[model samples]
Target: MERVHSDRSEQLYQLYKPLLFSLAYRMLGSVSDAEDIVQEAFLSWSERRPETVLNEKAYLCKMVTNRCVDRLRSPGKQREVYVGPWLPEPLITEALDSDSPSGAYLQKESLSTAYLLLLQQLSWVERAVFILREVLQYEYDEIAEIVDKSSSNCRQIFHRAKRSVSGLSGMADTVPLKSESLKALIEQFIHAVASGNTGQLMNLLKADVSMHSDGGGKVTAAVRPILGADRVIAFLMGIASKAPADMSFRIQMVNGNPGIVSYIGEQPSSVITFRMENDRIAEIYIVVNPDKLKHLPQR
Candidate 1:
């Protein structure tokens, strides 16, 4: 690869930063690591001459992918060293805008909390294959080149990845509905919890509503599931008490669903998402672990 001049490199970095960041983030499931990987790719690009570079986009993307694959393979140590539980980095996007079926946001399954949680179940290769296939739709050959594997090997990896991600032997059409009834139920439930209106919340909650928290052991939380509406409420209040003193709550669309964030000193500290069934809220997932909230930047 030929070295790019200083000015040319700046332009190239600006041009590719968004693409690289998105690719790295999705691949690694770590915003900080993704940013680091992209930066490293650019550094590698700089070290080579522009004369040596034949295909800039492909080269940069491949660099990022290779680094991400190694990181994925290497994170067992960090996962082991991590205190308590670990969760995926949280990122808040603009509300599920205009799901009228023509929007750019992948409306395939309405980015819900349930969906992201399921993503946690996939192996790194499977996640990478599924993301490239479903989210980016790259050809298997191109994917093989990026991952440095045989075409057949890549196909097999993708096949298994597809099954793991979809949790089915075959692909399913996963269109999500924007149920107004579910939103109403959750809004009322949040009010009940925030305002300590337990009676109204109880009437609305199921007898066995399950609640989970990704505290990452930085803060005290239930290591296992907290079952029942009564127990769920108690657990949530405990979380509220531990929230930063100046923290404020707001409702936002995250992963394409109604979600909550706690902003302490005007920076996001936590994000919570809900799962609903038949117009009623079924589960509440709280992600307070600082490592995961880095992606939800204020801007």
Candidate 2:
């Protein structure tokens, strides 16, 4: 009987693992942390008798959501004085690279680096409620159950989260630049930076573009966001001047969008992603922390 129950629990976990992981990842923005929460949730499930659970999916979702909330409320000690900017850990989802037209926008928008960054503004509960309601299509009652809030309160939280991030929700998707076009833009920008062509770089950016770098205090990076086209160009050129002769750049798909990865003699140095609006670059995110890039698969 115990073996049968265990088998049943494992089957259910497989069925819901992706959904649960997506929820946790979106909530926490750290692949390892989300994986940890999902694993612990499965362990909890394995210890329970199947008969005691009324709805397996809801039960698992609630467990994962609550765990993520706890993690958010009390972040890991290492992050207390994280150096420079603290961008979300990049996730490589190759499946997104070959998405079908019908689901392309939906998949791209949901996991885009811009959307994930915007999600950081909300409180844990509000983030949970907003992701469950807006992104995952969960009903208020279901979200309330997951977050331990009343349905009414969950609805209010969702509304507030929605309003807070409304203007930025489509920051990365509004332009819909073709993949080839995006690659071309990235190449053009790279060439301009390499040659110290400030005029060319400025033409590639929107008027109010910003650059953000996360060095996690392990390496050198901008202590604050660099804003405006001129300032961003200057920052990029300054970093370029310091680049080692052996450093190389590779075009890669990062978080379901076009991104550039920098390599310093086979060591991953940094990952850069651009957000396009009105046929120009609007926002730039660069992650240079060696600690964050440790998850990249070896070449």
Candidate 3:
């Protein structure tokens, strides 16, 4: 019956949809693109008989991954002249419980803005191999099938990708800063800026700290990275000094990490996430691009 077939199709879609979305999201930093790819995959699945799928999970994953690869290779040139420093779209994963194994893995490995930026350095196949084998722990043979490469070639690609991102890969295994610790840090940071306490702000930042903000040319923002603690602190203080009287900041999960979200009235002005080293903040990434923030709830 038509009803029976439709019900079965919906059931199968529900079962594997989350994992497929997660895979696509990691492959492409855009949540909107990932959702679109997942929807396309589901449409394809609906055309096939559910009974024919012996391994629905792997089948769905391959569909999404291949789509992401094609998307990456597509002739999209928007990022070429992007305003200011380019940054990944911040993904809020606060609903996921970090205590679970899957939650812990995603938070540490693929969801960080820094890790996503590093992934951009890899070729499409290399990125797929690295994510599938290293992050997801897929067997080489399985990854080969998904990527259409021989298992031996997949191994070589994985090693190559590993060497290319070795320095940036370590953060994937370490724990994110504790929520309370991050909240305290942001509070201290906000207070220092509000009080014009340069010394306090400088102490919180590493000497080699770098600040990058992406405003997508639609709003006012720095056109290049601000390096060194002194310059970065001055930049923050300058922004704070000119901030609107009604502006406020709140802690929110951005890209599976704690970050400060600034708002003016009901509109989000900026999202700032950090990369810490040796208990001090080493890097700051702020996204004020209106296009990227459209997915975020205004409140």
Tell me, what's the RMSD of every candidate? 4.3, 3.0, 2.5
Local accuracy by lDDT, each model = 0.69, 0.82, 0.82
Q: Tell me which of candidates 2 and 3 scores higher on TM-score.
A: 3
**Where is model 1 poorest over a 10-residue stretch in terms of lDDT?**
101-110
TM-score of each: 0.78, 0.89, 0.90
Report how far off residue 194 is in candidate 3 (Å): 2.3
Query: Which tens-of-lDDT digit does each residue in 144-256 have in candidate 3?
Result: 88888899999999999998887765555555677678778978988998899999998899998999999888988899999999999889989998999989888887777
lDDT of 3: 0.82
Candidate 3 stretches with Cα past 4 Å from truth are 51-53, 98-105, 168-176
> Model 3 — TM-score against the truth?
0.90
| Model 1 per-residue lDDT tens digits across residues 1-299 | 23237767888898777667666766655668878998999988877777677767767878987888788768563566765444556555554346432224333342455655565567766666666667667788777776677778888988887667666312254333474555566678778877788788777776778887777777665677788988987876776566566877777766556677778887887787777654455777878787677667663
Give the deviation of candidate 3 from the true structure as CA RMSD: 2.5
